[model samples]
Target: MGWKAAEKLIRHWKVLRGDNVKKHIKQGPGHEGGIFTVEAPFHASNFQVLDPVTGKPCKIGVKYLEDGTKVRVSRGIGASGSIIPRPEILKMRTTPRPTVAGPKDTPMNLVLEKTYEPKSGKGMPELINILNDVANGLGSSTNL
Candidate 1:
């Protein structure tokens, strides 16, 4: 949208002579030093969210459901009136995580084992201290 909008603006302003021009002249090594068309930063209002359903540019509109949860939908300019799903980029994980416990994970039996000692008069503080000691390499797995 940025480069396309800038190109459209420049074409529309062709009548004016070198006035209010926003262009890039490439320089330095590996650069042609010729005028290069680039994207021009524009106002947020001019930005359009692509309608996934219609595969066209659209204005985003919020719709409230009966549960009072708001959902984004396609509105105006080739709108398909369908709920807009979140962007794929946002949903993608840079690194995939394991769903199941791995070899490095603590055994379930050990994790479920109780370390509480009510007779010692130690409560959550004792558990915290044990965890801190383990993290600092002062405690063994047996202490857990």
Candidate 2:
């Protein structure tokens, strides 16, 4: 699968980050209902993953928390266009954000380069199955 396809699949999973929760919360009088506080259960510290082929970092997803702290939580990839998984999926999972000591605590720079290599063999079909599993898993976990 091409980079475009991989990006599309990754993008779909981005919603799991809980960035849109505030918009879904209802407003009320006694409580600041609309203003919901969403603590990122998982923090993505290293936003840019190095492409094996290009040597350049590909901007995979947004890095929450301005601090350079690794948080362990359920994490997934997001992309645009078609959905395709790399032959070797490099994923990182972490919890809550850590305390920053110095300037390094700040969010990492965004790598806007599209440096993904085209996937071979199982392409779109395999990607569909993977995405389905991810979607189902996300749905069930959020219910709890």
Candidate 3:
């Protein structure tokens, strides 16, 4: 009995722009990583726009057929045979690159110029020392 609802959903469903607009296509429910073609539902008809001049799957690309109008060329190819499509995005959905916070002076720098490279060439500091130093620096001389 949801005929009206179904019709409304179909009418409002946005057209899949192209492979460029989509990040991933569901390969299959059982497929590994669930990624495949950039196109959704992977339909051949959606990519059937042929170039008007050369006419073999439009390798020449979508062009103005004696009439001027702009459109995305097939495979991102252009009038000049230029490979216009940007190369597939490498490292898709990767975690943000760790920020290289340029040359920041840490809290330890307030007492010593460098934290990692100790003046005494000491190894890692004890947690108690760290707590004591931090407390003393915060205007407290009490030992932890």
lDDT of each: 0.76, 0.46, 0.50
TM-score (C-alpha, index-matched) for candidate 1: 0.36
Model 3 ranges with Cα > 4 A deviation: 21-30, 38-144
Can you give the lDDT of residue 5 in candidate 1?
A: 85
Regions of candidate 1 where Cα sits further than 4 Å from its true position: 1-36, 87-144
* Of candidates 3 and 1, the better by TM-score: 1
Model 2 has an lDDT value of 0.46
For model 2 the TM-score comes to 0.17
By summed lDDT, which 10 consecutive residues of candidate 3 come out lowest? 78-87
Please list the residue runs of candidate 2 whose C-alpha ends up more than 4 Å from where it truly belongs after superposition.
1-15, 35-87, 90-144
Best by lDDT: 1
> Which pairs in model 1 have colliding backbones?
none
Per-candidate TM-scores read 0.36, 0.17, 0.19
Candidate 2: minimum summed lDDT over ten consecutive residues — where?
78-87
Best by TM-score: 1
Model 1: ten consecutive residues of lowest lDDT = 12-21
lDDT per residue for candidate 1 within 1-144, as digits (tens), equals: 699887776553323225433577858888678664554545455567888877899988989879997788889979998888777796799899988999899989988988667787454787789999999999999998
Candidate 2 lDDT, tens digit per residue, 1-144? Answer: 999997765654432345534544666777655555464322344344554444454544333345764322222443231222333333543564555655655344534444444675343565556667777775443333
